[model samples]
Target chain A: MTGIDQTSLSRSTSLKLFGYHPVVIIVAVLLLFMPLIANDFILYQIFSWSFMLGIVALSLMFLAGYGGMVSLAQMTIAGFAGYMVAIFGVNGIASVSIGWPWWLAVPMALFLATLLGTITGALAVRTEGIYTIMITLAIAAAFFYFTNQNYAIFNGHTGINRVATPHFLGVEWRSTVPFYYLTLGFAVLCYWVTSWISRAPFGLALQGVRDNPRRMAALGFNVNAHRIAAYVYASFMASIGGILLVWGNGQISPGSVSVDVAIDNLIIAVVGGISRPIGAFIGALIYVVLRTFALDVLVAFGLDGNRFRLLIGIGFLAIVFFSPDGVIGLWNRWRNRHASVSTVRQGGAHG
Target chain B: MRRFIERHPLWSLFIIVVIFVFLWLVFATWPPGFEAIFGKKKVFLNAVLNGITLGGLYFLVASGFTLIFGLMRNVNLAHGSLYLFGGYMGFKTVAWTGSWLFSFVVAFVAAALLGIILQYLVFRRMEGQDLRQTLVTIGISIVLADLMLWIFGGDFYQIQTPDWLVGPAQMPFVTAIKSSGEAVYMTYPIVRLAIFAASVVIGLAMWLVLNRSKIGMIIRAGVDDKDMLSSMGVPIQLVFLLVFAFGAGLAGMAGVVGGTFQSISPGEDTRFLLASLVVVIVGGMGSIPGAALGALLIGLAEQLGSVYAPTYAVVLTFLIMVVVLAIRPQGLLAR
Candidate 1:
């Protein structure tokens, strides 16, 4: 059996455990000091936004890369969690919110969001490829419409506003430094968990299912269940990001769950590199930076600021056309070329 | 009748009766109990008629979507943008020349040319890669949408149909009975009828070309087995290009027709695209008849829901889609 290669599997697992690259350490160190170096706007608006968006994109990356399921409902799932928080937790819209404590509301919101993701996953796993995209997109569209219309719960199009952030142990989590740390901690935890999962047996089996489900099934794997499980894990990650996002914005609105945002999640995951978790963060950084600055640049050039999406679209197209594997793929190619060049130089010296 | 009923267990008859009762309640009872819920009976009739015409417009857009998907396996998310672009072009042409026919032709040609460019530049390179193609099309759509907003100034615009089709036409068959037992005749916009007629003609023409012509045969074969068709010297790329252009041209035509009756706004691109998606998904992907059927169901659901439950109109179509998908995941008419 293909699963019988125990020696190579153990060796690979050990290598993964010990393979702490220097670049990762350097990047981590830099991120740890970001809030200290950056100003309030930079810390709150750019970095925190990037981390939250990155977390959601990372969840999408896990599903698409490992489960072969390109779901368009990732944003919808995030939005659902945000809505749950708004409904259960205290908010400015006091009439609508039930005003539950953070300790109780957070888990309840995450639970409901996870259930929604599992149900969607169960429905979506029946289809393949393009149909899967259609189904997830339909769900996203439906959710958007439902929330936009259902005034009793979602407060109609305006959504619930002024959602209060968690306050515990005399820490004002909404402050820049504390919020940044909170976001960073969650981001790092998610990234680490996703990386660990990628090397785990279930993740390997899911990848097998992604490449060839029939072969994986022949090898005694329950493909759909595994896919559903992946969705659950991804939903938890996205739910956490969504809670953070709502706190960051201090609101939850129907606009936040728009189809454009859903598509943006896909674009972020794709532009970063769908195969790796780190790529999602890298892509989020690029996207947030561009979104923040591109409008200013456009207005400076006497162009319309509203057309910033045009530049982003163009960038996405160019990136996809040039490198389908995204920024990570480009990095890998460059590294390979550098390694080959050095080896060639060494061979010449030996000759 | 009794023997037939006995053989079929009366389920069909019961369904017909239920439908008739629903229609009666919707169309013939002014000041009825539902008036409190769904407005007046006149509004219900208008909604039904409106739904039929809207379904026709939806069919015009979705037929192209289905054709492309059936032939190339490419889900062109930019389709809605194409529709909106064509509408804008048609609007400009009409403004310039005041000839609805000329505007229609110009819109079709421009959209077809754009489609050709898209196939060669973007979709052609991605070929069978569905995810990449989807992303590329989305990118193209975003740029096109932004450009259109820039040029069109984010205002809602509608094409003016010819003077001959501007007035309302009296419908002899549609008579709503008031509570006083008086018959109230209903009138519908002539442009709506024209739209329905145009859609029917387009649907028939497409059916003929797909079923009768040699090119149609080749397209059908390609949809079934692309690799086999290519190996048999069919020049599948040429067929794909032709199909893509033709599909895009159909969307342009739909834009013109839809623009005549409804306002074309910046957001209409995604709306039409979403409608077309719902149609194809419910009717069955890659099936022309399925697209038509699905469009009709969605149109009726949307209109009826708007009248009965205005707040939930959008959700109604989605509900239909979800129900259909749950019951038959391959859709109603999967090819």
Candidate 2:
């Protein structure tokens, strides 16, 4: 065998044996070396925000991909968790402030957030497709205006502010490098769990329900129970994201959990490709990059920065128009094309 | 009397009327007396009038929303973007021509064209694919909103009415009495009165079209069953496109009229969008009369709510939405 051929074959075999898709392996390598290549701000913006939003979007994907429920209320859950943290800390308008340490507060907040999600999920899962979306939207709308107006409990329209980052192991988790690492660890953990669950029996059953619920029910699966469980699982991921988002922004406001934010999560998930967990991270990266950089580009052209939204809207429309499967689908198509070209070359050589 | 009462359900009717009357009397008498005794500004009447005008504008927008939702069965989340787009378009046209007549013509045509293009490009392809379409259109709406922000900036812009229709007119009864004992005339803006008239005309036109026209019959039939209509060779796609465009055009007209009455700003998109959604939910998704009635309730309620409790104005509409949904999941006028 030729020297180059031997090396290539070994590399391909190693990728297979490690059970790492080329995309995942590359991403892992990049993330491992990201600190070396990127400055602190770049790391925070690209790695941290991507991971945080990815985690949030992952929750939505779980609902959309596994449970066959497209929930717009994921942001609402995150926002709820965020508000819980602020309220429990010194910022809440309610007279009842917990003032608990991060260890207690975060867990409590996450738990409450999960319960909120489960309730929303329970209410939402009763309907399917468009109705599911509308109900979640209604719930989200209710939560939004409630937060906007309920000054006594939620601190009203301005929302609660100055929520402190959790101090874990005597380390301030909000520091750029530390936070990025913390986020990376969580993201990797969630991705692994998501992949693992998608392959598990429950995941298989959920898929069965997604593809055909009536048949799954006939086979003795409690479809509603499975769906609710999926929502609970998804809510856990979203709560984590919400917690991280609080740390990232240093505050939680009505805007954080607004209808726009809910829709933004949907856009990120759709942009990333709903088929996998990594899709959320990828989608978040794309959305954040577009949103962050598009401002600079518009400003450079002497155009108002606010118009960056217009560009994002156009980009989203185009993405939906062409690739309903999103960026992952595009990546897959490119990979498939390369695979075909290589296979054709191999056939020619053999002949 | 017992037989007549049973046949007419007089007790139930009597209770409803009595409650309504009691509520109205309490609202009318208590607020003024409290204000007079407490030496507070008797701003309640003025606020209600203002709220009515605001509600009238909302009705125009929400009626469009209800029409599209009713016929197409697609909750175009981007409807807010369209509403904002119309306002921006009207603003631009007014900027260009500097004439009210030309501005109307330009705004209407521009908005209609925009509606047609959006329908042809985005919504038409989303016919059967509901979820993706919603997501896609939301993106489009955001982009459009951002585009407007880019073009117009975040600053609020006011559409100037004609010279003849500017300013407010004098009223009689409320004006005659004040703390100073001077004649205080209740002033109403001419532009707002014109908008109300225009809306009535537009609503009448729509009612006639839907109730009378053959095309309207086809549209009603299409809404009933797109598949059944298509099977009969009724170009369902075309009908959807038309409906989407028509809805967008209405949004545009409302924006132009709304801009003249109330200032247009970047944040107006979400506010009006939510209001329109509320209207559809309250009015019953496909019912025309429901949109009008829902609009009236929303408008009056908002005015009255703000007058009585400024803090509760936002909650009032949302509370109404929740209550309506709980009572009738199909909405106030759903078929």
Candidate 3:
């Protein structure tokens, strides 16, 4: 934190007065008052979901973008946190839930999720880069199967339903606007933290390990330690996202932690662009919009409404195929083509 | 084998003890005390048999997976979709032609063709980039799964055993002694035994082809150094395509086998995919015998765990994986 980059700092400060300031201000104002312009359904179902999913994907973006580790267990970590919350906190299933308050349950969930993520990370870090994906994926699948099969704690396939959400300061946090802002607060916090971490010394070391592990090791950095630390950090961030997700849905199930959902998390991170923190939110927003409205759009096109998965898959394939960097890559390509230096400053800030 | 025993004497001794215990459990009658603790003989034998048969199916799927995805270093996440596709194709072939044998052929050809397309289109284009290839496979798997779901609907389809392969085949293992002092023998589904035998033959054949044949030498050289093999005048791409097609064909046949033993459905793709992943991870990627060993261990763990614990079967399999990963990250038999 003390050793700030002289070049980036100078450039950002120069841009503060002119370039990206107006756009940032406009986006901030629009997001702050989105509830007034959008309906309850859009606020609750669309935006909140995007914020929650964005937060989860941000965890992935941090590891993949900065640390050079692609973990499929991000959603699993989120689901584990959600499951812990439902198990520890108040729920309709008295046999499963111990009826603890949110304060007690939430921290317990975060700690346990981080612990699980750390263990998975330690094991995953035993191998090289590509194996991380396979190992994490296998772990995710194992968790899903275990949750689906075990009823004593996980409540089997039906899962823990009718879970209670937090309420305080004369505000029902689960209500439309309140919940939207709650998720927005979390999304912003996670994004800021992720962005901050990318510039931190540890993050720089991680990028070094990613780019050249042999050189990093020669430079006296513990490569495995860095990768595992990245997982620990990402998992803690993902735990927050998971708790918010459970609160948003008001339930936790094995279906929520299924393999497809895990893959969808990867898709969100990739489609948004893993290079920057904001890309997670952008990817999540696009995914949420597509999931919410693609049904009607499909029907309009005389296709099966259920074919949204195909659409998402094809779109994801296209992104991976043409724009491997996602939306950010496409934007950079466009800006470079047009030679628009001022507009490109925003992308440069993250790039 | 002798060198392995020489290097790890304790492990060799432990393996010998395990083999002896397994042989006794299979060939000898269990003591009353042992039966009391471990349940009845019939149930134990049935579970063991089921585990072995399941291992055969796993080996069928995983060997192909290990070959193309593991050995070839081609990331093919859509492998499970290929499995389901083969199963559906086999089911349709059986439903239309009523020849159970023909279904296997149809499924193999169908999956192999799909494999060829994937290899040519995807792997050929991006040979060395693991992450990009993985992402592409993920996308392909998602699209394929959705497409198959659209076509097959959500119903489970199990292949019917032919008349010749139907019914239980009695084994010599004693289950119990009747009041009349006549010993009862154990019996198992004949189709499963046949499938297990077939898988063993296929496994041995693959091992022979990989180890003893000229083509195997060429393939092994390619694995070590692709550039060298190409310079040596081998048709390396053709070899890769054939291997991929062959592996896919094997997975397709395994699907038919799976359909007979257990029903195949929509989510079965993910299940089998995970199973293969665990198997390869445990067995060591790209090693044939490792896949077989890993498959058998996972299958036995799963069946026995399901029988005994019922709730934590997955945990048992995952525990094995974690243990293997902790002890030998490259797998137990990785070269």
Q: What is the C-alpha RMSD of each candidate to the true structure, in Å?
A: 4.9, 6.7, 2.9
Sort all candidates by DockQ, best to worst: 3, 1, 2
Worst 10-residue lDDT window for candidate 1 chain B reads B25-34
lDDT of 3 by residue, B143-257 (tens): 9999999999999998989999999999989888887989889988899999999999999999899889998888788878888888989888898999999998888888898
DockQ of each: 0.50, 0.29, 0.68
Report lDDT (Cα) of residue B125, candidate 2.
59
Candidate 3, lDDT over the whole model: 0.89
Candidate 1 lDDT, A229-289, residue by residue in tens: 9999999989999999999999989899988899889889888987678889999999999
Q: Of models 2 and 3, which has the larger TM-score?
A: 3
Q: What is the lDDT of residue A30 in candidate 3?
A: 92
Error of 2 at B312 (Å): 4.2
Q: How good is the docking of model 2, by CAPRI class?
A: acceptable
C-alpha lDDT of residue A231 in model 3? 95
Per-residue lDDT of model 2, residues A1-351, tens digit only: 001112134344555636756866787889988888999989998779989899999999878876778998999998888778776765434463557777777888899999999988876665577767766776677688778877777877777777777776888888888899988988888888987898789988988888789999999999999999999999988999888888788888788888888888988988887766677888999998887788889899998676666676777777777777678667755655676666322211100
Q: What share of the true interface contacts does candidate 2 keep?
A: 0.48
Q: On lDDT, who's better, 2 or 3?
A: 3
Q: What residue pairs clash in candidate 1, if any at all?
A: none
lDDT of 3 by residue, A1-351 (tens): 012232234343544645566667788889999999999999988899999999999999888887778999999999999999999999999889899999999999999999999999899989876788889999999999999999999999999999899998999999999999999998888887777887889988888888889999999999999999999999999999999999989998999999999999999999988877878999999999999999999999898999999999999999988877789778756756565556433332221
Q: What is the lDDT of residue A197 in candidate 3?
A: 81
Highest-TM-score candidate? 3
